[model samples]
Target: MSLEIAISIVMTLVIAATPILLAGLGELVAEKSGVLNLGVEGMMLVGAVAGFITASLTGFTPAGYAVAALAGLCASLLFGVLALTIGANQVATGLALTIFGTGLSSLAGAGFVGTTITRLPALFPQGLAGHPIFRIVFGYDVIVYLSVALTLAAAWFLNHTRPGLILRCVGESDASAHAIGYPVTVIRYLAVAFGGALAGLAGAYYSLAVTPMWADRITAGRGWIALALVVFSSWRPWRLLLGAYIFGAVMTLELYSKAAGFALLPPEMLAMLPYLATVVALAVIAMRPSRGRLDAPRCLGKTFRAGA
Candidate 1:
């Protein structure tokens, strides 16, 4: 590819990766804090719908994102309550949360079908006026910049902050944290809520800056991929960022390859790139027989009773 083509490809990857990066980062925080939130996909759906509806009504993209994030936070908070406070099964509650989110989204967005909104504008000014490299690196709507910032912030917070230390403590051993007066349940609750907000923001980015339209299955399976990426990244924020972009590049290349007359690969294979990458990564991780065991929280998915 020529320099211009290369720049274009990189730009496409950056655009494609923005949403996944957001979701993956959120999942990273949730998991690192010692909670297995299986409802990320559901949270994304709720965000998409909530953002779409609010944006359509208010004609303001920021307001849409705000409501969407709140909606996602509320949805994920419910799941945290079930899995942490009530001591429900994490897997079951997560599955139920997905179902509930899907149904609620459908009901909420039924009237907004076939609608479209003028998405939020790109943030880069003269920097991207005609500079291909600069545009590729800095050009994009507000969501993309925010997502990237969040990634850096998350990485820094997780690796170098007191709250992050407490979070990691809760994830590694809630009992230990509680004994040290860490308020394990509260920490987990907030972590899950933050995760939800990010997930929602990711979904809103899709609706407001990507598709900019309301539709069912809008999120497709991006949520699952984000979940997979968290595991593939070993719950590291920066690794999660890298993995998400790779997945995003694969997704974009799949489409471009098919459209660009590259008949070298099967159409089906291209279509399966996202899910296939997840499986391949998981397999690679699984094959490392000598790899150290994961340091999952002692009571990560278990309910925390106050005095039980």
Candidate 2:
């Protein structure tokens, strides 16, 4: 490929990876605190629609993102109440949250179908952001950079901070954490809310930056891909960034192949590439030795009861 083509491809890859990276980071934090939320897909959809609607009406992308994060936060809190407070099965509650988010987003967005909005602008000045060579490094919007920063922050917080150690303790042994006077349920609620907010912002990236338009399920299952990415990364933030980019490359294949007029595979099959990668990655992880899977938090998906 020509240098320009390579640059274009790399730029596309970054855009494709940003949402997954953001959502994966959020999920990683939650899992570190011992909560397993499977409704990431739903949260993304809700955020996408909410962001699109807000931006469409107000002509401001930032407001849209803020609203999207709040929407996701609300959805997650519902899950926390059911799973943590009411003692519902975590897996079941997560699934229900996904279903509810899907329906809620679709219903709320019904009137906004086919709408268009201004794409988010790049963060740097046009001279830098639009330059042929420099654009490679400076052309992206704030969220792309924010995703990387969040990765570094997450890694540091998990390994270097006192609260981080406490969170890990809760994940490994919530009963022990509770016995030590930690508020297990409260910590998890905050983690879940954080996850939901990021998931929402990731969804907004789809509507505001990737496509600049609204449609049903605009995220196209990227949320599930992000969930799988968390596992594929062994719950490590740095690995999650790497995994998101790898998946991004897989997803970018569909667009590049279509543009390059490669007809060896049908368009339908091309579209399946990312999801196929997700399944394959998950299978590979599952087949690893039991010890390899021990990187996951010990109390993952377990409901914590204070007195039990």
lDDT of 2 at 182: 94
Question: Where in model 1 is the C-alpha error above 4 Å?
Answer: 126-130, 286-290, 294-299, 306-308
List, residue by residue over 193-292, the lDDT tens digit for candidate 2: 9999999999999989999888888888888888888987888999899999988876686678678887556778766765676677667777878755
Q: Provide TM-scores for the models.
A: 0.93, 0.93
Candidate 2 is scored at a TM of: 0.93
Candidate 1's residue-wise lDDT over 211-271, tens digit each? 8888887888888888888877777777778888898788777666667777656878776
Q: Each model's C-alpha lDDT?
A: 0.82, 0.89
Off by over 4 Å in 2: 261-292
lDDT of 1 at 281: 73
RMSD of 2: 2.0
